[model samples]
Target: MDLYAPFVRHVVAPLHALYEGNPIYSILRELEQTQWLSPEELRRRQWEKLERMVRHAGDRCPFYRERFAAAGLDPARFTLEDFQRLPALTKADIRKETPRLQAEGMQDVRIRQGRTGGSTSVPLEFVVDERSAQRKGACALRHNAWAGWHPGDKVAMVWGATDVDSTFKLRMRNLILDRRFALDTLRLDEAMMHDFARRMRSEQPRVVYGHSHSTYILACFMKKHGYAAPTVKTVVSTSTVLADVERAEIENMFQCKVFDRYGCEEVSLISSECDRHEGMHINLDHLFVEFLQNGRPVGPGECGEIHLTDLTNVAMPFLRYKVEDAGTPTAHVCSCGRGMPMMEKVQGRVADFIVTPDGRVIFGVSILDNFTAKFMGLERVQIIQDVIDHLIVKIVRGEGFDEKVVRGFQDRIPEFFGKEMRYDLEFVDEIPREISGKYRFTISKIPNPFQEAAGRAIGRTPPA
Candidate 1:
């Protein structure tokens, strides 16, 4: 038996169990249990929560209070219909008003500062209080529940960040949470991957969760090399768009369901696909989601920008916050019996949309899918658009990278764009990580004023 197995079962398991019973956890658990409410009931409850949040912010948050006053809006009489009347708050708005947003009488309003890994180069710093933190943790647990993960189920995380310090509190928390593996995604070498495969086979984790791109890359290597790992019940991909090709390959290679999750740092676990394999279930109990087109709410099944209001985050409430992601709204009920609203798909983040010289826009994931089939053992790559007619391809060459693959991409790109664009292929040993430690596959240096304005409104700079 592994040396840490006993500690994991006894100490970590019990601690996680205790944490799962915390007040906030209980509240979230109750909501999840009631997720089968009728559509009308769900809407009623959502408005109630929204009203409470408006009142709370109007009283406690100096920023929202003043904004409401200047707009001649009364928080006490705020209605669901007035959602459009409220000004959208972007990441920039939050950053600019952080000082005023701080709770007045609370000396320790500093709580905790966290960074958002936005597609735009500009990251954000936000404060979270104890209640907010607990709510976030509970939301994560609820998502885990969809994959048959229990309170004490052993879990492994393949994450990008390398700043985890094993302090006493963290150590205790890990023990309680039954977390066995915390592999650093930055060091994804053959040896590291082999070691991870061995650990997974030995530990038999209930679920494996991580950045989709990195995990899919690892799975691809394992499948090509015929390395067998322990069977996980499910794999949850977060923080990036999971292309259909990647999803098919991952599911086949790992022998598990590939569940894609859409969320941001401001509100963790906003929507997740359930076991029924339906669309991503929006957490209506804790969030009020709006799909807007040109500043107006769109009807069901229409594509639009995603705006969200966090009902649980009282510390620094985010009201009608622009998340900068596009998706199609769905009013269709799920067979899974969950009354939570669903989103048909999260069309990739705003930065992933590339404008061509001919004014044609292409989705980043679509281009990657077209190229992946022609390339073998390509570890990572980045596509940079400097101008309408020029593109820089940064390739992190892997074991079998050859001229054939390069020529294939070179030929296919122009064929798709219908123009002979300048394509530069620069091969490197490894793609450099961003300041947040995650790699962005697409960036644009050319300034689109509209995109820049949108990015600024959301507190992120246009991706470049």
Candidate 2:
């Protein structure tokens, strides 16, 4: 037998077993049941949980202990205000503190090491324990519950990853769960897309979940061929930005509700769109979220970078972690009766913002919607803005490609800025995937003088 087989059976399999039956899953179920709680009651319980997590981190995590002390505060006496006083932690901070954050005398404090898909070009490495991994899975399940799916419901996952080799244990688990996994690491060609649609229709999954881009590509294919996956109850989009236009198109083609989820590898579920679809409801029970602009808290309905603390993950607690995404906070109570504050909109990642020559910022997602609405037979597209006046449109086209689609995209962009802008369309055979096998929608190459002057400047380079 292979030498590694023993390790998988003894270590990995057992860990997986523990993860599937952990208390985190139970906690998630409990939260799902509390979706009917009043706004005030939900707020009270969220704060109580946040305080407990803060105290736990102060007592167990050395990094947080030093942080609390340096701020001239006591963790035991910590309140919501005191928690807000702590400095926000960025990806750079986590990289710098990796060694110190590890537990004493432990060779590998991380039970698992997760790699970000390099959506920002600066792919992150986050460590998670067994409990944290379980929590992440449970949170994902709760999001699926929004679409009326149960634990054993048949589902199909179309996602990209660097590691494509699945072990025997994983295969068995998939079989037991009645789920199918599709690898969309390559561009969606006509033949491949046809095969995918065939499999999807035959399988008749309860829900389909994957990257928003890939899902949209599939939906486009179905729309053109007059095919629909009628049995699929829901199409869940994650891992990348999903525009309203794309969501509507997907729902129309797939004949299901499009539930968009937002989160990172560090924390499992941050916020999810509810049944009412008013906005994303923040998972305040498991996370404490803040919107910060210029290092200060922004009030309700203000847009800023999202800073979050994972109150559940004690092994590698992220205290005020800068998520590098822009969004607006909403104090409006949801019609669904969940008291969690709504995230009115997630304006995509900071890197997705295009800085124009006149110092105007255009949201990349808004531009993507314009193209998706008018363009056809397009597999993937990336927008690169090097300067205010210069823009590059990289298009991976499908069968029967024409310049008319490109012209249509060009025509719609001006409406986004309310001004005519100069851009060049370049058709390519493929848009290269990033190191982690995910495609980024936009990249800015123009160097920011402030970042360059700091001498820690890193250039932005999108894959291909």
Candidate 3:
């Protein structure tokens, strides 16, 4: 029934590519075939690309040149171990040494400046070249295909992104080629959800995409109010952590598979879940990823901090960049037969980990989802650990919320956080969002275990 999708995918896309002299279409075709390469072959290719990128960065980039020399690493002959010995790039480093991070003699290439969403309250400015942009776009397309979404398919978005440029050309492109139905999540209310649900029921978009929490919230609203959302072919959840309970709720409400994606503005697409839904397949072709603990790579199934080296971005090479995220790497090969490696799971951000009074550290997600969320009459919850022995529990009340819920928390706080921990409940009409329009369910004010171990390397000072 949707004839426009085929026209946009075939004709409009190619014409736009030709008009702009963009190679993304060709690059996408190449990635489509490369996804099937053997795992060993992919790793070999990654190593080759890494070698080339390292040499380029060391020779041309002032920042890497100084860093490599200080580390006593020769780009021409350094082994993988030597490369690992190089210092991890922090957001502070990027902020301070942005100009030096850029490669020299890049006057011919088109480069653009950008900033991160500051979801962690630490925004970063960086640059990306034209080729890197094209490649990242192509990589996204390849992953979208895995979720049953193509370039031209109608996609309803519940994103809180503020980076879009609504120029006339882009508006035309969205209207014709992209066919996007976007819901701005900067300020979501019941009225907005009603309108969104109403439009979705009539439009029947092929794909639904949004921040994980925002999408889940929309689905919850629709279900509670008896709004009939269309059953799209695929739902893509990205930007924030997608908990298992939230995933189940989204799937049940939308009647489709929720493909969770992980990435950042600094690096476009890191990994995405495929049709098989086993785990997220890493984009090995574009990034050299490492899971580190105590300055060394961790074994499979063990949690570690993620370090990324972008092999594709020559203008600004991010070698062993500390992404401030934690994830568990896995050696399990996917049955989908993709040669790309998999990550067992992405643990929440490092800043989201709470430090106990007894010096034990635990992920905030465990406290929020596994324990507090099960409480009855709770519409939303945010747990803030200001100090080791105190917590501020922010709750948005739903129907039937009363003293019983407060009593429930009083009993469970000791059971979960120990007897020494004290808490104050603040009933809120709605929880606030970050500047980037994403909601953080749990926030910790104190330094985590990794911060203490890494010290200033992670740009955070540990308690003396």
Candidate 4:
């Protein structure tokens, strides 16, 4: 057992929170209790927060005030229905009205500027006030607890180069308080994995945390080289989509439960899996989440684009902000008994959807997770759709790759896509990671169905 975990959780964390003048530890305590509230009660509390944030935005944020007036809508008496009718906020809007989006009377508050990783598109620069930052931090701590992690417990992190803090001050803090060591996925190779494995043997961290694909890759490398996998308490997969195959392999190698997490840079900790692992529970305390098909609300189990309203970010309000991601809402309650609602899983980024020649928009994640990863001889594969009628497949072959494997793969493509579609298979040494150090399983260049639906919803004609 981690004997020091209790001291870090109880004493050191609270002291650090006091030194920073933040209420993160206090907020975490509230979260700990609220998770067990009834679903209806949780929704009621969520609505109250939403109502307060909306009113504050209308009164103080110039962008929202003008927008509310332009739409002939009053935020003071805005109903859920009226909120749905309001135009969705886009990344373009934030870029155009950064200054005006900030709530007034924040001169005394500390603000921090941040940006998206831009793995799929251009990077988006935005700001979050100190209060919102604290709330996000607390929410993350609550999720970490679900994975049985505590601040003082040693952690092995596999993440992007930009995410790791290597400053001398942070290094000292890591040694004493945070207790984390990171492997930069940007420069990951067999050598780096070996070094990480050796460190795991020495440090013996209780938890393994990392981007989904990066963690899976590390596990594969360890298995291939006959490295003895450490017995960790739990693994947390974040940043990218965690496929079923990837999760199973990581769990098998680590000898631990994998807690899949979903979030974005703009809004931290959107949702995370509890111990039940049935589905990810949305963070209702900080966000008002909506699922839309086109511009309208979608029912449970139906695929829809996810829009988020930051109920906590009074510094820069993001109302009905379209995140360009798709997911399905669940009507079933998790056995974990958390009142927070569940989302089945993220489908994929809107841009990652492959539009077939027959006008079918299939989720890219489903293709890779359900079909591609099951192929025995294929170590990794990426699909690129530059034209409606064709696909370019990049394959990283494993030991048993042969003509039979090629024929078998060709046989399955027409089943998902129509017989009218054609594809070219390019055998590769390896699939390259994006500049953000995240891997993309599929990239479609064609205009997706969601774009057309969004254009129609906003009363604008989509590009021909």
Candidate 5:
């Protein structure tokens, strides 16, 4: 061990934490120790923290206080089951009740602004506590270590909306943090891709990370042009679903493993794949995740909507906050021997669901993934379900894609959604991204009819 570890931990790190108002290094130190505990030990510690969080929310938040009272919870004697009795926090709640949900002393908290891509037509502008960002950074550092990358390692991002301003402060920070380069993924033409490849050769970043589709496209371009660039040790795929073929192709071209990460802007670093690759481990020490189907906790291996409680983000406690994403829980321990439990996969988002006239909800993301990838000459596709009967399909035209493909879509899509469905497939040169500059493969406008009635239907006892 380095002799300065003591000086840095006891002196230098504390100064940084005080200045930044985030105990990043301190949390990182704690996280390193927590990962070694057994699964039961981890759960025991997590449960204790969760109990405190529940009581804190009930005491500090006016909205949660009212909810607690309604659930007959005596905050002093609350159990885990009593905590689950609280209602799920929905996006509408975030939009309308943020002030009510916020803690009483939030006025002095140093909060940061965050926003979603607004694919739901109601974009959310929420605030995160300053420390949540720090904790997330620490979790990321811990995960990156699994890929043989460390805190100061150079990493290039093939991502969108990167701030590349030449301001002195920004430049100094980027240099210090080792943000060597960030490829503008918005423009991936031949020249841009070639320049990106050239930059990778020059920068030799230890890790290359980006959107799953963008990474796959870059891999394809590199193979097509036969441009051999210096290798990066690992590539991280996030922000969208990573298809099986996309993961295989990216790994083959980059000659490194592609680790899939699942998260949203609302909560950061939800789950990540370790080197063993058996499944993605949940960040249990910081988050408590529940898989709910029909408003009840689904057992392991069953699919459900992801409900998360942030143990670390105390500024705005989103207890049992619905993530609007579907996921499955794993039953077994990982072969790698990590203490954290596993989440099999983030199935997809509810915004991607296709709802029908009779209240049928279809997991459109998976269905579309299955159909589109099988067909040739299909660059991209988005399913827009504005109405129950008429489905507007947008496609990026590729070679050999013409009227015959449109006829095939007319048959295949309706057969999957419902026989009564009508398809109007429109071919386009490109499908522009949302205002947030993030790509969503599917956008559904039809409201989920079962959302409101789910709680009452799912094993709820009738009142006396």
Candidate 6:
């Protein structure tokens, strides 16, 4: 067999990373040893990195320097406990003091500017050092291995595809290195799925990865159309929360395990599922993650907001930054025996909570659960609240969808979101992606008063 793709990856990819000041191989080597370390050893390393990172942020980052002084935190000699005593970083702080938070100097070095997909109408922009970039690359390769993909496996990305004029260099890069193709989730219509399946069947890809919802829809489409990705060994989902229904359907259709990963644009990969599939293992070497409710760490099995510290990114230290998602942490260790920590699951992003005109908020998941159970013909669903008094429900109707089901959905909306709002039921061919390529289940135009991202006041629940 011609192993040209694998051979080039094995030899040249590292060289490219090194030239760009990203030590991919070096990180890989370190991870190989660190993954086997004990949990105690892992945390020890995390504290060491945290100490260094916090000190660097305090000394160099203008925003942190002020906060550190106000909190009376001596970063130079702070212990792990001392670090926790410092105030948590919020999206508002990042927004109000972005320049101060950016690491100083090194205009000659690679400082990448990144933005979160503006699911909230306001996206946070941040910079990263080359060191953090390489560390993330290393973490990704290691995580992929857990999902049964080696360096050479042909990986397919089932994500947003660009327009008709994708550049030659980008196409060649995908052809040569990725051995991968994209399935424009931007429009997963009948024509798109047919064309995509044709290409995928030809490629016989080993791994197919995409936004969790997009991947689930693809699996359902393939099953309905009598197509099979027989060579596909594993399916990986990311960017969006994979609902229970989506997960079960994807695994059932693919006839393989689905490895779901959760992270964000700001800090890179947080956690990913291994073959064990019990829970996702946190990237301990790269991040210090905490799940908190009401500003304190929640007990095991309780859902809380995700607070993260990018241990490797000194250029912009995100110390205790709230990722604005809720998830449960586990005391139970993985059977796979990785030293990294584990989280039971990542709940949806804060934006996934839909708000009504009357200030009552509902999780898009609540809609999915009720609607999917009540209505039988949805391939995929997106709920958009673009105006205060109105909602546009986008549905990618499948086998059994009809006018009867449309009326059923309308009737059900009032049960969850009270009858104080207007809504439009738009049955579309497909659910498009955000500009940043991630898919969101719920999009709200109305703003949340107290905590915009959380979509609820400090003491309020969904409307009574």
Native-referenced Cα lDDT, model 5? 0.73
The lDDT ranking, best first, is 3, 4, 6, 5, 1, 2
* lDDT of each candidate versus the true structure: 0.71, 0.68, 0.82, 0.81, 0.73, 0.75
lDDT of 4 by residue, 354-391 (tens): 88998898777778777787678888888898898999
Query: Stretches of candidate 6 above 4 Å error?
Result: 12-22, 105-108, 161-165, 354-362, 379-397, 402-440, 443-451, 454-464
lDDT accuracy of residue 72 in candidate 4: 72
**Cα lDDT of model 2 by residue, 1-464, tens digit:** 22433454345544655675666456666868776687688778877777777777777778878989887668778666777788888777777787555444344444777555343445556676766676666666677778665555556666764122377766786655334557464554678778878887777677787777667767877777877674876777775667777788888887778888777667767888878888898887678888888878898888877888877666677889876676788878778877677987676542255666666665667667654546776767788876667778888887666877867777776665546467888888877765444565777666542221111111111110
Q: Each model's TM-score?
A: 0.87, 0.83, 0.94, 0.94, 0.84, 0.85
Residue 319's lDDT in candidate 2: 83
Task: Supply candidate 1's per-residue lDDT for 74.
Answer: 89
> What are the per-residue Cα lDDT tens digits for candidate 5 across 199-249?
887777767777776777788778767877467789888766677877888
In candidate 6, where is summed lDDT lowest over 10 consecutive residues? Answer: 455-464
Q: What digit string (tens of lDDT, one per residue) describes model 3 on residues 110-208? A: 987767634545567888898997898889888988998887788888876432337887677678777877788887777878888999988889899
What is candidate 2's TM-score against the reference? 0.83
RMSD of 3: 4.4
**Tens-digit per-residue lDDT, 132-206, candidate 6:** 787787888888878877655676677765432288876775566556677876565689888888788887778
